[model samples]
Target: MRRPTIKDVAADCGVSKATVSLVLRDSPQVGQVTKQRVRESMARLGYVYNRRAADMRSQRSQTLGLVVTHLRNPYFAELTMAIEDAATKSGYTLFQGFSRDEVPQQRRLLETMAEHRIDGLILLPAHDSRPEDLLETVGAGQLAHVLITRSVRGYECDYVGADNVRSGVLLGEHLGALEVSTVAFLGGAEGSSARRDRIEGLGSGLRRSGVTSPLALSLPAIGDEGGIPLVDRMLERIPCPDAIVAYNDMYAFGIMNGLRARGIVPGRDVAVASFDDVPDAAFQQPPLTSAAGHPEIVGAQATRLLLDRFEDPDRVPSTVLIEPELIPRSSTTSWSGRA
Candidate 1:
């Protein structure tokens, strides 16, 4: 069977080969009418563009590398899929890797992806990652990259992520309206930018509502522990918090589990809330209250920033923060002592 080529498409569309090539490249010079005609002709001729041949001629890979922290996290998982979707639509193949919040692992992944000659990279930096850690791969001009969801100190790049500070403020205000006093925060590793921003915002919101600042505990490592052990530590404080705000839904789930283990119902005994309103948040036993980060939006925006950066390498770095909205559910609203 003979494969249809650009020549056949051009012939069918009554356009020059150059015009067909322009349409294939999605150049702005091609008008919509001409593009439509070319596409229709392509469909009729079963013409498929040879992206690999085009890449070779252009000296480009047409490939992108994406490294995210904690792929198992539902929010991150959703964000990754969204990024891939956006990249595929833009005619770029995405290679994905999970860093698991480790600096060494993340550095290795970045180096490995760079070796493939990717056109660009999108990263969610690992906990405590320093700018120097990426010097050899990204900082050395080997590849252009965008930061997503997390930022590293001294590393400036296009970034797209949730407004963690706003997320915490929204959560705090909601809890304050419910008359929840003496709140505590659990989960997230110490020194994470997201955690620091969220904690700052929570404190601001609490103080604005005449509530005292929250007691924050940064876990050294996040795992299945789910803040089970922190329950006792919080209880032992001078005044036990009536409510807890977790770093994210997963942490909230763990705290809820721990509370249940102590014969304490999340909504009935102590209010619980968290960030990132993943799908499962609404289906929990008590239905968790959460601030929705909208990872899909973050992912899409990050891809846009990276694509734009590729188009204009000399442009200044950009940062986009998608605002979060708090979703109140039984977890916080059903606080037994709410007055």
Candidate 2:
């Protein structure tokens, strides 16, 4: 027997194929009587709707892609889960990829997603990504996209992320109140907007307490292996840094490891703080002090923004910023001693 299609269901129900298609899509515009008849006919005929064929007809892929810089980082891992949860709840099947902190990889992943005809995208661009690069790969406003985490230099689009500047300021204030004099900011070498805002916030917050300048130790990478060189250079060059502000918990962990090897425990000597209070931050040997970005909330916001854009493409672009909270822990001050 031949396979059943919308046409078959329509004929059996004595209705038009358009009505069957509307019912298949769960469109609310169809009347209740017609909707019931179409579903009944589909059940009687064992008609299965082909989503791919319907997508082709409507020029919609029925898929959305999410691309972030690196999933190895716990912050991104948590953020990804939140996005996935929100996307699934909104009835979307997602395509996810990472750029591996490489520009070519970012371009390739985006181009591939575009080829798959993704209806929209949420991007956490790599350091090397530029507005022109994105425009070339995805086309100029062709694929509805939202820039999350970090916005590209010249690409004006919807964005959602934690307030990096305020987070930095809050972290800095935590350290400043603890009387940290000589501090250093490690990792985050790339010239992304988030990096710039964070650095400025740290400076602004610390300056209020008479700590005018902070030594910026820009590292090429923020992995555990890279932490050793960063520690070595910091110790040799500025041995008296009272505190260290790492880019994220992942970097803070690496720095802590490096400090321990040099007989400098984090809580007792040379305090450390981080952003994105990841799962491990709370359980580290000396719990890491951090600014909580609430990655899940940010992810959910991004998902909502993307979904909203899909509904109203002509809507004006918007930016959503969530402020982070400073979570004090053993890494910055003695866990038990802190009042």
lDDT of each: 0.83, 0.79
Question: Which candidate has the highest TM-score of all?
Answer: 1
Question: Weakest 10 consecutive residues, lDDT, candidate 1?
Answer: 215-224
Candidate 1 regions exceeding 4 Å error are: 1-57, 216-224, 236-239
Residue 123 miss distance in model 1 (angstroms): 0.3
Candidate 2 off by > 4 Å:
1-58, 139-141, 216-225, 335-339
Tell me the alpha-carbon RMSD of every candidate: 7.7, 9.0
lDDT of 1 by residue, 247-282 (tens): 888888878888888788898888999999999999
Across residues 161-210, which tens digit of lDDT does each residue of candidate 2 receive?
99999998997787778777777877764577777777778878888766
